[model samples]
Target: MIEYLIGIAFCLSSALTVLILLLPSQYDPATKDKPSVQILVLGDIGRSPRMQYHALSIAKHGGEVVIIGYKESDPHPDVVSNPKITIIPLRPHPAILQTSNKLLFTIYGPLKVLFQIAYLWKCLAYTAPPSRWLLVQNPPSIPTLAVASISCFLRQTRLVIDWHNFGYSILALKLGQNHPLVKLSIWYEKTFCKSTSAHLCVTDAMGLVLKNDFALQAPILPLHDRPASHFHPITNPQERNEFLNGFPETESVRSSLAAGTLRVLVSSTSWTPDEDFSILIDALVQYSELAAAQPELPEILAVITGKGPQKKMYLEKIAALEVAGQLQKVTVRTAWLTVPDYARLLASASLGVSLHTSSSGVDLPMKVVDMFGAGLPVVGWNRFEAWSELVTEGVNGLGFGSATELTERLIELFGDDKKLETLRVGAQKESTRRWDDEWDPIVGKLLGLT
Candidate 1:
């Protein structure tokens, strides 16, 4: 069945390639002054920050950007207000595709890909303005890669793929590596990705993998994720208090904070399968036990923010722990905040926790980058090889392998004020390195903006 769909996609792409060769090139007088670039994302535009950053950077360099993606959440104000940037939202997947039943998923997966291909083609080839380049995100690589490649060929646009992680590797997490679906995804990604004009990856290790493993012929540059100027430390006590007070969720912990008996620990998650919230929950449970026995230990208010599938399940687990009288000195609260508010939360918090253990092991988590941007030191999962690149062992942040290790790191940081301060100072130093500093030189040249 998957083979049938693949054959159909191939036929469509071949037909489009021949048709485009026969058609006259499109020239718009209005886009003559600005070099147009289309940023394609198969996921939500607001949630995909790296692509948004790419759009922003392109616009800054006087390139007109058309962002094509699902607009489920509101994007950053800067992106919304940019005159040179235009957003073309794609049709969302059907509600039935959101089902958890394996049978339903297996049946509808191909249908979802077909729907995505048609819509993506329409948006890329017809609706969006003709552009010099089309930059796309990977990991939804199946139909997205095929559609973008076809459309770029049809429109006479350069195809640039920004590799976050291997899409096949992510799929392998749900289906075993030996699964036929996983194999198909691997073949699809490798086949289409080879045709990209240029490649931008999240980590240098990823770039190496592309060259060594995939044998990609394109110029691959590792453009690491860095926070925008909007993400900064909230130094003013009044500003911090005001932001925290604005949220009703933080009300219960305010008095404890004022009394200097509680500390705020912030963790931002998509509540996805890749991030194991169980580790965090276990660590928090252990912390609660320790804090109950030691009166001098600080009470914790853990603020976990983001929307995803596993959120309700984890929330229920946390609730059950509370009901059973297990979590006494620790409180866990979940929230979905605006971009600005999220930055404020990170800045105001005493520490940050990252649950992301990369699916591909070569990619670094952008959440940790955001946390560092807000001058909050992170206790990230350290199993991946790429973790060391962004997080230094004793400098900016600490790392943990298991729940026990995480709990121990938490105890050490929270118990010793001086050690936490040193890490915070390191994180503040990291905050100074903004996105544009790295983006302009490499990415600008790739897009012919430099």
Candidate 2:
């Protein structure tokens, strides 16, 4: 009995040892024979759509991309299906690292060695094994960048920065153009850009900002998300019903519109102080006469999508305006929509709305691309510095100046069915020719699958 027990113990111990050896390791895999490039993607991997897309892009590029992301955002369903993608969660709270950021902010402000300290704290917590190569996807959080920089130094790895959002621009917007923090962020951007192997950006606008604003010579890789393609328009009742759930009272509106009520659909981030949704809302109020006179006149419904930090404030404003009856008139889709679903939803609508005030002129939202893909006519409020050039008035879409002009333009378009059809066709052509055309190549090149 004693001999048998000893034999079993030995077998169990060997099995346990093998299991330990087979566990996942952070060490760079053996790449002596293969062309191995390890990329360490960091920063807002949870929030930034571009970063989310970057995972797919890197995997498609055929590189060994290891993503270090925040644990708060939960699993990205689309990314989970890709086998080549490896996600490492950096847990965010109840830990010294998270608290360390507060300390750094207090000591040095946003740009002080504070980010570096927080990053170091993250490094200590995430210590597992090191890789031979690393790439950072525009480390926005100073601490995260510090951690990434530290990892590269320790591992003797290459650091690649993808600047999707210009940090200085954001700081300038938040703290004023001449704010000290803005200047510091600008300095950091200049310092980092000169050293990185490649600086990836999404638009020529950003490239100009880097070259002119910062004087950097890094190669700019203009990355665009996959554009809308092959979306069948909403024609069936069941399809319309699905869209109605998102649009609120779509069925009644659809019936009324078919009988000659001009139906205009609008969607935006929210009725934020900056968005100028009030401009559109006020326009509708001014055009109440038009709605009444042409009982068959166009009924305008603005669909508000996305929840923000100021959602409650906006909701309160909506209620205070007594536009709750207009709730059916202007629906708010509070839940997040996947990129493809968002595209389809936009396609079902007649128009998409985008407006920016002086404070947010530089924001070229992802929705603009979706609107183009869906071939929906866009009514953009030009506040200067906007990509409003994309919407040429009376060509593919219309550009409005104020609420009064916007209301007049909508009424004009509502009466002209032939013009609407012409614009719709032009919008579709422009969208497919320009925006959606780059998808296969962009995705292909990024994945190295091309």
Candidate 3:
């Protein structure tokens, strides 16, 4: 149970946490000195590639960055070790380390938010200077907005709220869509979002909802999350060998590589219920049946990487599936890799399959973006506006509505090398094409406060 609590905090690298910036302005002498751009993410700094970009963006603009986040272990310097960036990690609160039980998260989520926000507030009160703009990640532990809004008002700084979907939507996934708490969350988000200086979201789908449904007055900026340029494919054999060596099981499967029968499908998941990995597992079951019928099909391996509370449950289920069968052509492997190793695996894999359907039905999955960055095509499910925006049906990748359809799509993706290769090429071409230009200017405008 203790370990599970720790994993909950570990896997929640993307959610929670925040930053309250004290930017220099005309009112204080601090304005004449160095104007620092501090970033606060209640989650792990290394866990969030988006915030890493934010830090780099600040440094690129000749501003210092101070990140406030929590990590269970030693902080990974790869994200915020920049000379211009500083980190002030908040100690992990007991609430953050709660297990996967929704009841516990429901009870502790607010506590975790309050704990970290208060800790950061105390930390910043003495160490931070008055600043121009303060940005907070949206759907943050509900109370984050009200507290941050108060701080912004007091500091006379423009507050920028980056919406990733209502936090209630995630709660809905854990609880239920119709729960009164979920409905109340929707009301809470709508009420607070209108108080921000400018609202930013990951997709136009969310922006539309904010404007049309929530009736928010703040300017909605759709800033698509992107991977850094370092996230790319590898050509060097030595580097490839070293990365593969990280996984002994994968390294031992050289037979498939030599026989040309091994087709590797890689997926990075947090193993949460929101991801609905059971759909992928079920689809694989159907595919396995087809492979048994067609002996000419190539051998396949599905690699799912990540750690979370659900890992043990799914592993047991997967074990049962494997044993209840004859010799299978496709095998499933689960791995927990570091950030660098995960990126390398993504780059080397033949295909990237994502089971993530945004919990908010509005936020796009970062895993899909990372896959595209690694020049790997993606297959996933999303019925929301994300279908057209992120996965363009037949263009970049395919999205499925059911397990049966997804099975057919996966078979098609893996059946031919040419089809998969074409997607790989398309992904690479898209990666070379930057979406950064669209949103980078908005960051400058928001951060450039008078």
Top model by lDDT, which number?
1
2 versus 3: better lDDT goes to? 3
**Can you give the TM-score per candidate against the true fold?**
0.94, 0.73, 0.85
lDDT of 1 by residue, 1-450 (tens): 999999999999999999867543553535667678989999989999999999999999899999999999999889999999999999998887777666676778888888888788778777886888889999789898998887777677889999999999988877778989999998899899987899999999999999998999989999999998879998787888778777777788888887888888999899888999999999999999999998888999899988888899999999999999888999898888889889999998889999999999999889999998999888999999899889988999999999999999989999998999899999999999989999989999887788
TM for candidate 2 is 0.73
State model 1's lDDT: 0.89
In Å, residue 193's CA in model 1 sits off its true spot by 0.6
Clashing pairs in 1: none
Q: What's the alpha carbon RMSD for model 2?
A: 10.2
Name the runs in model 2 displaced over 4 angstroms: 1-47, 71-76, 90-141, 224-242, 245-264, 270-274, 323-335, 338-340, 356-363, 386-389, 433-450
Q: Rate the local accuracy (lDDT) of all candidates.
A: 0.89, 0.57, 0.72
Pick the winner on TM-score between candidates 2 and 3: 3
Off by over 4 Å in 3: 1-34, 73-76, 95-114, 124-129, 235-247
- Span of 10 residues, lowest total lDDT, candidate 2: 93-102
Candidate 1 regions with alpha-carbon error over 4 angstroms: 1-31
lDDT for each residue of candidate 2 in 172-199, tens digit (9 for 90 to 100): 5445678676677767666755655456
